[model samples]
Target: MKFLIAFLAVVAVALAGPIDERGAQIVKYTNDHQGISGYNVEVETSNGIRTIEQAELRNLGNDNAAIVVRGSYSYTGDDGQVYTVNYIADENGFQPEAAHLPRA
Candidate 1:
């Protein structure tokens, strides 16, 4: 019984470390977009297709996500369209539209 408990404790610590690391990654991504206000891109992955919206992005500083500027992107061409966009992060930052971002 003692051995089982010790093994469980070790397993819990191992699992906890990864969770903290993932949480830190999320914070890094969120902080990377801080104070951004105006026309910005949003990236998301879905079951059917990936999505990128050219909406006004605002850094609300909340964990959920950076705020999307309300009602400002209704007429934008890429406003509501869904696409197979892949959001790749590099040394520069989050590249929602890989094609549009200039190659370094």
Candidate 2:
């Protein structure tokens, strides 16, 4: 998720428009984190971009546990369509569901 944020920052800078103008700003934000326990985050921007995520630690017993995370993010495209992706990451690995993703 951190990598995704970084990549988006780079892309935003590259397409930030005029040099003298500021880019999109945050319109709303919320975060609740408790270290390994888990976290929940939500954010919205001046542009039509929004992200929401929630995660929790689940114990599998016998001193084993894992963090289960699920989230979805959406952004307005140049063509005026809103693109969104829903994903999950846990013991099974990353799984993303979106119309643009190719099927196996």
Candidate 3:
């Protein structure tokens, strides 16, 4: 029983150190002046294709972040439509507004 307890304690300590370091790195990155970061994705559908482009800018000092996204859905035989949205995230939460969202 003693040997098992000692082994578990050692394992716990080793795991805790790495977790702390990773958490610190995450905090630092979120607080730094990083340029826009995002990705683009494309998908194919039976009727047509869809593409999405998104980017985000972070202002950790102000505890705020901004995001912009644009997407398009094209039909195989019909003209496609594109939509755009802007978002701001702060301590409160994420607030999004559509710049060119289609209405049903």
Candidate 4:
């Protein structure tokens, strides 16, 4: 039991990874009111991170009404490569697409 516990402890520490000491600052940001129905947002960070999203009300004032969201985000990975993901969430479900993702 002790050996198992110590093994698990070691695995946890290895998986946790080292904390980054650097700080990221927001370099750009924008929020726009697209009327009473929805809004749009965009942001960029000094540390090579960016995201944009838009939301709109669907089926307004109905029992099945929902807010549909569409968005994309990009960030620099540890390997120094930029990764971007585009996504949408609506009546069906959340779908994300990116070059790195495997084909279904």
- After superposition, candidate 4 runs with Cα above 4 Å error: 1-22, 34-36
How would you encode candidate 3's per-residue C-alpha lDDT over 48-104 as one tens digit per residue? 333333445446346455554444443232233444444544445656566454444
Tens digits of per-residue lDDT for model 4, 16-79: 7753637778999999988869889999988788999999999998899988999999988877
Which pairs of residues collide in candidate 4? none
RMSD of 4: 9.9
TM-score versus the correct structure, for each prediction? 0.24, 0.72, 0.31, 0.73
Give lDDT for model 2.
Answer: 0.88
Q: Residue 92, candidate 4: how far off, in angstroms?
A: 1.6
Model 3 segments beyond 4 Å from truth? 1-36, 58-61, 76-104
The stretch of ten residues in a row with the least summed lDDT in candidate 2 is 15-24
Each model's lDDT comes to 0.39, 0.88, 0.46, 0.91
Q: Between the candidate structures 1 and 3, which one is better when assessed by TM-score? A: 3
TM-score of 4: 0.73
Listed per model in order, the count of residue pairs whose N, CA or C atoms clash below 3 Å is 0, 0, 0, 0
lDDT of 3 at 11: 94
Q: Candidate 3: lDDT of 68?
A: 47
RMSD of 3: 17.8
Off by over 4 Å in 2: 1-22, 60-63
Tens digits of per-residue lDDT for model 1, 20-48: 22222211111123345544344322222
